[model samples]
Target: MISVESAIIGLFSFSIVLLALSFFKKDKYKELENQVENLTMIVMQENYQLKKKMKVLEEELLGNESYTVPLNERYETNGK
Candidate 1:
């Protein structure tokens, strides 16, 4: 016994509810994206620091004379 006009109104109301739910989900997705960006920046900064520390260690090791012994001389000298 439902009238055509009433059915149309009910369908419109359901559409509006679905639209609002989609909008709310979009906002939540944006918030999660911001959190991920922040965490990525922190990880990148830590990675850069670690790379710098590794470079310094490599320089120190390369600067030592004992570590630079020529291959030919090593065989000529007694295994001291």
Candidate 2:
């Protein structure tokens, strides 16, 4: 029952609506992508900082000054 001209007009209207919707959402999508990238960079920096801190702590723990008591004297000094 639809005429060719009416069908063409309907198709054009649908295309315009879709284009408008896409245009409106484009900025929001770009903003989300940028936020994700920023968050990823922050996480990577935090991970690097944590790794560096852990290395320093490990080195400090393994230093000779940490074990002030000799192995044999430890049991004699402590009741445990």
Candidate 3:
């Protein structure tokens, strides 16, 4: 027969252990979460830089006199 006092102690101990295990899980993944966050930031920055470069390239190409005209312009000039 289990005593009421022992039952209460056992329940309290189990609750404490469950809480500790939950904390341990967070600690274990803390490092991995930081790594993933760092990687995401890096990728986003690189993507933004690439977009800027591409926009500059497009503008440069458009400003170049020797760049080919669109096919529609070619057709218009040819049909003139």
Residue-level lDDT of model 2, residues 8-78, one tens digit each, is 99999999999999877747677899999999999999999999998788669857543556667766766
Model 3 lDDT, residue 51, Cα = 90
Q: How close is candidate 3 to the true structure, as a TM-score?
A: 0.62
lDDT of 3 by residue, 37-65 (tens): 99999999999999999878877976754
Off by over 4 Å in 2: 13-25, 64-80
- Model 3 bad stretches (over 4 Å): 17-26, 64-80
Specify the highest-lDDT model's number. 3
Q: Score every model by TM-score.
A: 0.57, 0.56, 0.62
**Could you tell me which 10 consecutive residues in candidate 3 have the lowest summed lDDT?**
62-71
lDDT of model 3 at position 22: 85
lDDT of 2: 0.83
lDDT of candidate 1 at residue 50, scale 0 to 100: 100
Question: What is the model-wide C-alpha lDDT for candidate 1?
Answer: 0.83
Q: Give the Cα-based TM-score of candidate 2 against the true structure.
A: 0.56
